[model samples]
Target: MTRVVFVLLPEVHLLDLAGPAQVFAGADGFGQPYTLDYVAERPQVLSAEGLPLVARTDWPVLGRDDLIMVPGWRGPVLRDGPVLHASAVERLRAHHAAGGTIASVCAGADALGQAGMLDGRRCTTHHQLQDELAARYPRATVVRDVLFTTDDRVVTSAGIASGIDLALHLLAARHGPALAARVARDMVVYARRNGNAPQASAMLRHRSHLDDTVHRVQSLIDTHYAEPLPLSRLAAHAGVSARTLTRLFAKATDGLTPLRYQQALRLERAEHLISQGTTVESAAREVGFEDARMLRRLRR
Candidate 1:
């Protein structure tokens, strides 16, 4: 089983921790088995919301399949949050050095900095602390106004609810976008937050409607985005005629037909593959394009 360990800091922001926690926990409802472990330097950590949280002081053994995360905490100022224990910082470094994935939510990036994980990495945090984080870790590349960033094995989120976006993206990478979308749907999240992805995931982007027909069509498109799908097939799945499916789809997704939405998913996946060093032609083929022609046109 994959282990997800959360390092609880003193006065941790409740949502900062809970958002990602709930995301991972919801994955279990979708048949993804993940063991969650909470570790802290102290036995009782208080939340910014005045809730006391219990954690284990003893660390768990983790490996490459494991994920260790730091949740942001409350502070008077960006530079004034609770300082992480030396041993805790060492644990973060050791985990990453062991090929484990490390992540942070909001101001938790500060703790990762203490672990030296931010050194020469691309990361971000709550906008309020972006300047402070950059000034403190000059070697790190801090991208502003983004939900999350990933470099090497380190992932960081902007703040608060973005943690959910970060966790969902991680789930997509581990499992697949279809599973991640189901997880997001189970949580009532629109799955619209793209984090650093070039385009939003279909699970949430065109999902702001109560039309069951449109939703069914979108669900079909999301799971089979790389396949050639005609409007007639989508309409058949939705139990509607092709013209009605087109009209309802437009009404649901702000004028985007089912075909356009599928293309969006394809383009987004293609861009991600290309960024990971896949050739444009290969990426296009992988995302269902007959050739690079449409991909090139969409990219342009």
Candidate 2:
């Protein structure tokens, strides 16, 4: 079983802890063998939302597969940061040194900074705190306007609801995208959304619409983009005629039809694979194209 440990500091945001906690709980419910534990310097810690939370004063022994997360609290961060016990800070640093993953949400990056994990690593926090995070951790590369970032084993994300996105990413990497998608569906949320969407995921760039029909179709495409999904199949899933589905999709997404949107998703995934050193032909085939020619045309 994988042990997921949350290091709770004073005045933590309820959602920053709850959002990712819910994701792991969902995974465990699906029989993924995740055991979640919470550790804090004190027996009782108050939430930023005014809820009281009780936690364990003793930490569980963590293996390399285990995870440690720091949820953001409400503060100016640079002005008055949450006080982390020096021993707790050492646990954060030691876990990473032993080849484990460390993650943060919003101003939680401040804790990771104090643990000295963000040095020379790419990280991000909420837009309001990104400057403060940068000013405080000048050695770290603080990416702006993106939903989240992962470098080595240190992960950081934007503020608030974006913690869900960061958790979904970890689930995708640890389990698989399919299981992560299932958990997201169960939670009635999408895995990604626009913050500076173009820098995020294809799933985020085109999800700014409110039509349920278009959303249903987009969800289908998001999971099976690498498969042979024809327009008729997608339309049938949306319970609309192909022509009607095309019209609705275009109207919702500023005139990009279902086929075009699928191509965009495929193109985005292909670009990511290619950037990671996959050959154009291999990337094209992996993304469900007949060959590299169409992929080349799309790139141009």
Q: RMSD per prediction, one decimal?
A: 8.5, 7.3
lDDT over C-alpha atoms for residue 197 of model 2: 37
lDDT of 1 by residue, 3-70 (tens): 99999998899999998899889888788989999999889999999999999999998888899999
lDDT (C-alpha) at residue 164 in model 2: 86
Q: Candidate 2: deviation at residue 116, Å?
A: 0.4
Distance from true location, Cα of 18 in model 1, Å: 0.8
Q: What lDDT is obtained when candidate 1 is compared to the true structure?
A: 0.87
Per-residue C-alpha lDDT of model 2 across residues 1-300, encoded as one tens digit per residue:
999898888889999999999999989888897898988989999998899899999989999999999999988654597877898888988899999999999889999999899999999898788888889889999999887888999999887788888888888888887778788899999443423333445577689889999999999999888888889899899899999998899899889988888899999878767755689999999999998999999999
Q: Please, what is the whole-model Cα lDDT of each candidate in the order they appear?
A: 0.87, 0.87
Q: Estimate candidate 1's RMSD in Å.
A: 8.5
lDDT of 2 at 279: 98
User: By TM-score, how accurate is candidate 2?
Assistant: 0.67
lDDT of 2 at 76: 69
TM-score of candidate 1 on Cα atoms, chains taken together: 0.67
| lDDT value, candidate 2, whole model | 0.87
